[model samples]
Target: MKRFVQARAAAFRGAIGAALLPLVLGGCATTGINKGQINVISTADEVKMGQEMSAEVAKQYTIYNNAAVTAYVQGVGNKIVQHCDRQDIEYHFAVINKNEVNAFAIPGGYIYVYTELMRDADDEAELAAVIAHEVGHVAARHSTERMTAMYGYQFVASLVLGQNPNACAKLVTDMAATGGFLKYSRKDEHEADELGAKYLYAAGYDPRGMVDLLNKLKGLETTEPTKFDTWFMTHPATSERLARVETEIAGFAKLTSPVRNAAAYAKIKAQLPK
Candidate 1:
């Protein structure tokens, strides 16, 4: 009887392995933004990481509180998100009270823009371009990919798989200190710019807005170095980015009469603390 039971258990184990073979093979196949990339981090973990990092950022900076301005930013962000490819994830947008002319996106969909960046935008389209660029970063899973590359995939996987909140928080915070979350490689930036323009065009916003913002930042790189420093200090806008964005804009020529929404942007700009 014991020998019969042992044989049955062995057969069961083999059957289980056979059943799981297809699943294992499917998991190995690449899809979406993770295609051709070595991303071991799962989607749920990416959202958790963004939530933790976003909370940390909120603790460090004051969230801007102007009702109308906040609403306007959210409106623009929402529109771009609707046209984005990664609709499976929820997106969060906020304006920080800092005067820095910069914006960043964490894994998942946490995107933040500084007040001065919004205030400095030439129009609603420019602001949308900035938000869309960050969205592109999130949509592309750049941060998760970056972390996977920086820290080995196994190391990142362990924190997420451990299912410990504190461990996940600590891992994200440590990455923040290393400037891992703050900067993207120039290749990443180019990808973001191109993707941002594609989103802008899809959302009926002129893709030229991206080109305009890049030009504005490049021109500011010399004249008002200090003010521009707020943005360039962490995220450097290079000549290559400008050229790349311009080329991207050119591709959208067939997109007819994209909305610039200048007057509405002026009204939102007026609400900012002067």
Candidate 2:
């Protein structure tokens, strides 16, 4: 099984490299985001790619079925999205039924949080912190940027165009099995932390929620390392990230009142599987 998976991953990588060779050699046209980063995939194509990839994700993992729990997550995610940098695409949020403590965003605006992460959060603000960070990745176009840098723009555009279904499926499959093969860099992780704090503050959630969530993860890293393996695979060091989040929160102007919404979140938590 391991050899078969490795073979599929290698084949997918080779296929993408071959398909994108021309665009890489000739240099492709790029689009700009708020962060001034260039992306080879346009917004429309990004959304299409996300829709396609999300379908594959749905096949790989079971989405949490409780409407109330899912709706609560969407509500928090929407609140953060309102204050995000990109508004071109509609954001979709869902909870995965998996027990692993992780959250991830795909090419477009689709963000997913795991049930274990939700159950672990102390309040709504902490949950919002994770969602905002994922939203930050979306706003900054980190996924497509990383994809463009790794696979080349033409290869990703081909996925958007449905030019190679087998390669696309293999790519998503490898990502799922490996806890996200399309991992972001340390720079990308820091930028997302900064942006998440900004959104958390602007959305009327206490900016400290970001700090608290990072600290919680840091503790989990020390105590229950296995639960955080997938999260740490995608996200870099929690201690460093927590320090940066604290610095970001320190810069925020004091608001009259900030929201944590612990009570509401507790109700939502009760609805999760025990």
Candidate 3:
């Protein structure tokens, strides 16, 4: 009887795999950022997946409730998004009340920055650099790409279709505990840094801000390793990355004056809870 039950379970698994094969092959799509590369998730479905996962993220983290600060972040993010490559979807930025130095972007353009990261920024340019990097990830469709690579097209399609209702929640839980979909490949990270520098320059912010932000995070990695844990996990900062970003920034035309906006950022930073 036990042998028969095991055989049935095996057959059930095989049947499920067979059923999903068609959907996986049919879902092949190309990314806007890299036309040569193929993605199994469509943009519309990626947006749906992002919407579901964002709701789960909200349930897991406390969103900072200050209207003025929220608007400020949205404004900065908008400046970056206007110059980003992917404008098909509207971008949303919010602040999480947690005191951790981390920021991440979900599929479809939802981005979250922790309060500690905001507090640590010395100027608006620094903050904008961070937001632009996350925007870079969104524009490149890195999160969904990573998800498709890790979980397979069928599992990702199931999450978007809501066929596996609990899967989104499980993904969010895993993201909070481990990096999950938030953890991107090194190549993805390099592309984001390069794109972010370009966006920062086009948006009228100093591209050097990206360099400064990396340097700041590098310092924190040594002095306050605990605060940098989450960011370090998802976005590893290395000397090579910093040097590459510097080279990218150096290639840009020299601006007579670039935005730093230290005073404005100071006023907004003052509003955060002590």
Candidate 4:
């Protein structure tokens, strides 16, 4: 009887320890990607915080106002989302009614497709390429990875590194407020390119959309986005990353089918914000 009572006490202690974990640890390292360059911080914390902050951003921008346009974005988005390895994520995608010629994703499968990108795509694969890249961010666990990196000094907070919880909270709050959820390092950029290309092929979209999207960003780098802060900082479409993506697709098994859905792409273009 005494042994069983002791075991019950031990079990209770274990439960208490588990509950206290997040408070002390702050939830870092969510994805399976190695501790290399990608954001691999605690995914649950980042996703929860991202959902909180996303609510604020969503309120400011009206979602894309057209049903057919929304449907098209959702359809392409759903196809790519399914092929992703992160089965736990639902990937809630929406079209933001902004004319910034950009798209981005948040942790926990929240993806945003701007009207500008929709209007900009000349083919359906172009859109798929973008979705795959965003999905790449999710799959790579870049959100949590970036958060771990973005906090930059959470290790300092831990007893393992430096033990500074207050500093850790400050760093996280700064990231949350500034939208530093996940921005890939150059290595992360290349890795996502590779994984995104793989997924692009898997989802039945030609990998060229990766190249096309990069090319478009290269051209657009000459211009400034309408609200230029978060997206630009993270997605640096460099010449080298772009070039490597081309090499990857070229090396893949040849895709005999046409990649672009030109007619569908154009019909939706008319509805986007100019």
Measured over all alpha carbons after superposition, the RMSD of each candidate to the real structure, in angstroms, is 11.7, 3.3, 6.2, 11.9
Candidate 2 lDDT over residue span 1-274, tens digit each: 3445445545556666666566556654444245344455778898999999988888887888899998999999999999988888999998888778888888888898988889889999999999999998888888887776666556676798899887678767767765653667789889888888999999999988888888887888888888876676677788888877887788789989999999999999999886
Evaluation by lDDT, superior candidate among 3 and 4 = 3
Instruction: Spell out the clash pairs found in candidate 3.
Output: none
Candidate 1 backbone clash number: 0
Candidate 4, lDDT over the whole model: 0.65
Who is ahead in TM-score, 1 or 4?
1
Error of 4 at 93 (Å): 0.8
lDDT of each: 0.72, 0.82, 0.81, 0.65
Quantify how close model 1 is to the true structure by its C-alpha RMSD in Å: 11.7
Model 4: lowest-lDDT 10 consecutive positions: 151-160
In candidate 4, residue 5 scores what lDDT?
A: 30
lDDT for each residue of candidate 3 in 1-274, tens digit (9 for 90 to 100): 3234335435544545665467557766556577667666788988898899889988988889899999999999999999999988988888988778888888878998888989888999999999998888888889877766555566787898899999999778767765324567789989888888899999999888888988888888899888866566566556888999988887789988999999999999999876
lDDT of 1 by residue, 160-218 (tens): 66555565666545533432353456778777777888888898998888878877877
TM-score of each: 0.80, 0.89, 0.89, 0.71
lDDT of 4 by residue, 92-114 (tens): 77888765665666666777787
User: After TM-score superposition, what is the CA distance of residue 120 in candidate 4 from its true location, in Å?
Assistant: 1.8
Model 4 segments more than 4 A misplaced: 1-47, 152-182, 223-232
Report how far off residue 144 is in candidate 1 (Å): 0.6
